[model samples]
Target: MAQQQWYKGAVIYQVYPRSFQDSNNDGIGDLKGIINRIDYIKSLGVDAIWISPFFKSPMKDFGYDISDYRDIDPLFGDLNDFDTLIEQAHARDIKIIIDQVLSHTSDQHQWFLDSRENTSNDKADWYVWAEAKQDGSAPNNWLSIFGGPAWQWEPRRGQYYLHNFLTEQPDLNFHNPDVRQAVLDNVEFWLKKGVDGFRLDAINFCYHDAQLRDNPAKPKDKRQGRGFSEDNPYAFQYHYYNNTQPENIEFMRDIRALLNQYPGTVSLGEISSEDSLATMAEYTEGGDKLHMGYSFELLTDDYSSEYIRTTVETLEQRMTEGWPCWAFSNHDVERVASRWSDNGEINPTQCKMLTALLASLRGSVCMYQGEELGLGEADVAFEDLQDPYGITFWPNFKGRDGCRTPMPWDDQHAQYAGFSSHKPWLPVDMAHKAQSVALQDADEHSILNAYREFMAWRKTHTILLEGDIEFIATAEPILAFYRTLGEQKMLCVFNLGATTASMPLPLSVVTEHNELSHHTGSVNQQLLTLPAFGCFYAQC
Candidate 1:
């Protein structure tokens, strides 16, 4: 078989730096701490590690609000430390992809600072700024995802600036040619520094309505959590004028052109749009845009055979040449084990089954830290909450802090669960402590061991790596599919329910490898009985 692309069916591990490890006893994870763990990460059989933002920021939205594009935040160590990390990660044959917040910058950023200083400044038009209406209201009916108006009044400029997120994170004006070039230069700066690629954060929000038109009010019945709260006024509008403008496409082409200069470099964009699947297809439709894009399709609380099959099939139909990266859990949403399974109490055998199912999917996969250990969400107390989003919507939405807790390294209930000498940023859960890496490392049947074994087994299957997926139509709770590439074909059958489900195959296709067995029983003839949450992979 011919060699496939570097990213085709590859597994990418996501590292939320603050919770990964702590170096210098600062109680916060830094670049050096990540460098020290490169060997451990490389052993996971993943192709790359996508580090969440480490750029200079005020931490208003964690690292998403960037104060400087070129420098490292002191909270994440110095530039030398980042350089050392790149060297170490590359030495282990692991590529490093840093998060790039391209849609906006912190209000504290020098460009925004200069733009707000005076209307006549050289950088005055670098950000989205508009004059208010006669009643001293915002230029449009746009709303911020963090609540309140999307427009923040700037007294110096005597105008309201656009902010899709926190008021501190003012949106950049990609409509300006100069602004687009400046952002591309920031990407080239990192490329020259030996970075592999970037995970573009909110890449679709780079442009807005040029006319500054008012967004029509969205009906109450139609509103859902596409990043806006139902209680917040932001959820009342269609958001047509504020984001996902057509002007953004040209800018993507320019950015892709720059990345093309580096042979092996790739770009993965995060599309958090109202129609994420459609936007994902648009952003990755051609070779001149993103190499791969992921949406929040599988990150929701909905867990059914139909939901999973429909999502993959819909994207497969919409995306012709574009590639996709599928992820169930990240720093943003609740953990999958908790969201999909019954209150996160999935048995160990089921966890292995789920891991195998995810690894065998059609597209690339992203595995968050602690996922291999079957770690559930940390039940963070209200008093210990550090996330502004969670704090603003507390009692109802407990924020992302539950998923961003420190990684458990040891089984012993030591200080910070062996993560740091000082208190961790988020409290570690007692349940996670029991499932620590050290504890699972010794057990052969542990979730971590299963993940390692499955990943190793997956590396040898070319059909699973670059195969075409064809779903087998069946009743609810039984998801069956086949992955075929050239002459290699494998049938992947999964039982998503908690009871035995019998699936019959066509009699004519039965072969020597037709034996179907789960953790419960064996199969005979055309009937295959699958145990609760059981999975089987057979060569036919």
Candidate 2:
């Protein structure tokens, strides 16, 4: 067989800097801490690590509001420490993917400072700015995802500046060629540093409507989605004029051109749009665009078999040339173990089953940091909440802090569960302490071990890595699919329900390999009985 792309069948682990591991006795996780755990990361069988932003920031929206793309923030350590980390990771044959937040920057950024100073400054058009209406309201009906109008009144230039997120984060004006060149230069700095790839954060927001037209209102019945509360005004609009502009695709082409100069380097974009699947297809449809793109469809609360299958099938139907990356959980959402399955209330069979299920799918996968350990969502109280979005919605929506808690490493070193000796930036859930790596290391069937086992076993199946997927028409609780390559074919059957499900074995196919793992039910000559959360993997 010809060699497959390195990303195919590869699992990318996301490491949120503040929550992964802490060194220097500071409450925050840093570069040295990641270096210290390189071996641990390698053991999980993930191909690459996607480290979240660690650039210079004012900490308003954490590191997402970058002030300097070239400099490492003091909280995450200096550039030398990052070099050590890159070297260590490379030595282990693990690639490094850094998060690039090119859409916006902190208001403290030097370019924004100069742009806000005067109308005729050299960097005056570096950010999105417009004249206020006669009524002194916002420039248009654009709404910020964080809340309120997207426009922030800037007294410096006596105009309103567009901020899709926190006011401190001002969106860059991609309409200006100079701004686009500057962003490309920032990425080139990392490419020169020997980084393998990048995960572009909110790449679609790089450009917006040049006319500054007001966004149209959405139908009240279809008002809640994209990780926002139904009551949030941001959810009430169609957002046509504010974002998802046609110009974004050309900007992606420019990014692709720059990346082409760096061989072996790839780009992945995170897109959240009205029709994420369509946007994902559009963003990655050609060789001149993103290498792979992932949408928020799989990160939602809908866990039905139909939803999962349709979401994948819909994208597969629309996306002819684009490759996909699937992820169930991330830093911004609740943990999958808790969201998809009952937490401590139920056994971990479901978590292990999901792991195997995701590994057997068609696309590349992204694993959240603590997912291998079967970590559940942390229940952060209102008093300990740090996310501004959470504070705005309050009791109804507690925000992303629940998913951003510190990683638990050991039991003996439980001062903050070995994450940090000092108090962690976010409270470590005592519940997760019982599920630490040290404890799970001794258990053969732990979720962490299951992940390692399945990933290792997955390498033997060439079809699973690079194959076309076809889902068989099955019942509500059971999901069955076949993956086929040139001459290699495998059948993957899963039971995602709580009750036992059964089906007659198809006489046309033969089960050549009995590789079924984590099995609980029986498969006689004629009938296949699947227990709750059971999975069947075999060669046909």
Candidate 3:
């Protein structure tokens, strides 16, 4: 296998800070709490940990909207705590990749606050602002992902500022050289502090149409949810002019140049565009932009083998040198087990099989916290909802709070699963408690143990990491593929359905075989039987 950067096929574990651990009994997870868990995280065999933003923010978007890119949020702990966390993580051979919100900043940010003061201030043009139309309405018909108009009028500046998300999180003007340089400087600041890489948030939304052209209306039939409910007006537009502009390529080059300065430093852009897959390819193309990019392609409730095959194949065909990171769960969406579970019941064996399947995939893999325990979504009451998105579009859509609940480390009966002394930011479901890390730790056949075993096995196989992937077409339910490198080849088969499935192997090409069932010993045969959610990894 050819040698490349560590992140190329690395397993990145995402830690949603607030839900991970609480150190000071404040009920919110802090840096010290994360530091305390380094050994546990390292035990899982992940190469790196991608932390969700913990920068000072108003929590309007739960740290996605940043007030200070350099400092840690008081709720999460101070800079000293963050420094210790970084030192501990590195000591365990775990790289730290932080979320960088470059496209926008919290309105409380010093730059935005000054910009809002008046049009004459030096920072007035730092954010995207425009004069109100003759009718005293928003400058355009663009709508925010959160709700109404994307443009919010600032009385002090007498101009409408653009915010694709909440109004409090104003969009930065990437067209301005100074703005671009400032964001890059912030990135350098993290690099100086020993960060390995970044997960760029809303990367495709960095720039807009210079002429301020209105986005064309999308056809009613063509309209899909813009990471929001279909009922939200944000789905009405095609969003062509508002984001994913052609100019984004130049900006990515600038960012890549900075990353190139630090050896082993990589970037994974979160492309949130209407054409996310296409944008993903664009962002990572030619190896001069983002090192890798991921879209919401696998984050949805859809759990069909056909959907998975098509998404990967399409990106493979379009992607030249670009790489993609695949994730089934994150802070923004419901847990995959709960989302994909039929009628809300998931078999533990099936969860183990799924973990093996994800680890065997071609691209870099991202595992959300608590996913290894086969944790499902928590049912939160409307009265206790803290997510603005869920609160705004209640009844039809419960926001991301369900998945953002705290990690259960102890037994279902323990208080707060031993997470904190105080109440958590969100309630932990009784059902999820049974799948806590402590419970799984004791069970040899638990999903957490399966994850550990599969990840450890994966690290020994270069073919599973950087190999070329070729799909083995089957009728239905059975998804099979082969990963081939120089002279090594491995076959991976997964049963994506609830029933037992069987498939015939290509015996002509398979001269030798060894199965990694995890639950059982090797099964080297022409015909394979897969129980519900069974996965088989073998060498030929």
Candidate 4:
């Protein structure tokens, strides 16, 4: 049999380009900035770096609204800079996975512009356009994720086009063979550029229901999850027809076929639907589809041992043929340190414990930038908010600006935290400076050092990386699982609470060696004792 793929259990670090660093003092990070910080990323011991969108865009929804799929945005850098970044990152043994927002493009894109011009235009059907209802309203009740109706009127075409996100981002018609080929050509462009893989953005949203069906209204209680607030109208619907269409499965096969031509290239899809876990499983299951898939399941306000176990186990049971990728935080949601902590405060121990738990999960991991320092969500004021989603929803949601703030590199660089010489697009939170890389590098017990140590240690354990996971039933605040591969078996347990807790030993195993040194827990006779937010790992 062929050997397991490199990305099967790899750790990927996500870099939000605009906030990672500002090499030119432009208050925004660029490709050059990522190249400058490539060594630092290497020090994290990650197998790859998944960069958020840096493609040419109108910046309406940041880089998620691509105007030119083949070019780099001038605000970030040119193709030369990207080539240099790829070279530098590969020199350090780190792979590059760029975000592919294939579901939509900025209204300013050539295809969208042409499609919007006239019904007879060559690209007229490239996007989802429909005739208005007799009452001159949107054809259906679909709503934009950014709020308001999903359909936007184009006077020239005299029809409303579908936009699942911002009105500026018109959904591409994957039903069009030309559109599918064009999107694949764009993917091939990046593949030829030598990127190791792609982090397919909204991969499940590529196709819409052909019948233009109206999404059923979700009851008030069921409307609160997947990063949408109860106040946002997008959360009011079941989101069935607008995304996760049945045809997306075949499109996934086409994408996988293209990647198969490029040996060692991988595809990691982002799936969010009414039942994201099941969709994630379906997208990654056949091996002819996505190599790995992740969802917003763990990246929610619900944080507990039971919740985590249920989420992981549910996917494990459903995903019998495909691998899963897990993440706790990303550029879109609140950082885990504050989101999971008591009273929204930063807890270094809890951060460490969560890191250990995530790494020990059954699949690969994606860690966002600044997670190593246990950074909390920043408090951006109303006037300072740049996220359109936050501006539309206001106080209750606050968009994603808090999590997109600049990374703190030097605690002593009081002005900009060493992120930029000038003011950043968003201000760096003062609380983050105290836990900067410069300060953490000097302290052995700091979250940054602990993360580095644990990641480095994790690389040596094959069982932890490629084993079959089986959860052991435990009470609240205590998560226990065993990872066994071949003749090797390792027990991973964590105390996710604030107080010390003990549980009967799941198995009779003496501690030959413990992987983490910063832990404050121990395994005693027929019992496992864990200090608050402590974790334990040992071979049986």
Most TM-score-accurate candidate: 4
Off by over 4 Å in 3: 1-4, 509-525
Backbone clash pairs for candidate 3 read: none
lDDT string for model 3 (1-540, tens) is 222488877899999999999999998998888998899999999999999999999899899989999998899999898789889998998999999999999999999999999988899889999999899998888889898989998899888999999989999999999999999999999998888899998899999888988888889998776356778888888999889999999999999999889878889999878888889998898878999998888887678888888888888888868888998888888888888786688677777777777777778988999888888888999998999999998988888899988899889888999788799998878787888889889988788988998888788888888898888888678888999999888888888788878888776544334444443222457777777777777677
What lDDT would each prediction earn against the true structure? 0.84, 0.87, 0.86, 0.91
In Å, residue 123's CA in model 2 sits off its true spot by 1.1
Ranking by lDDT: 4, 2, 3, 1
* RMSD to truth, every model: 2.2, 1.6, 1.8, 1.3
Query: How does each model score on TM-score?
Result: 0.96, 0.97, 0.97, 0.98
Cα miss at 14, model 2 (Å)? 0.6
Tens digits of per-residue lDDT, candidate 2, 188-287, equal 9999998988999988889889999888889999885866667788989987777789999999999889888987788899998888899999999878
Tens digits of per-residue lDDT, candidate 4, 345-391, equal 78889999889899999999999999988999999999999999999
lDDT score of model 2? 0.87
Q: Which ten residues in a row have the lowest lDDT in candidate 3?
A: 514-523
At residue 98, give the lDDT of candidate 4: 92
Q: Which of candidates 1 and 3 is the stronger one according to lDDT?
A: 3
- Model 1, position 169: C-alpha lDDT score: 95
Give the Cα-based TM-score of candidate 3 against the true structure: 0.97
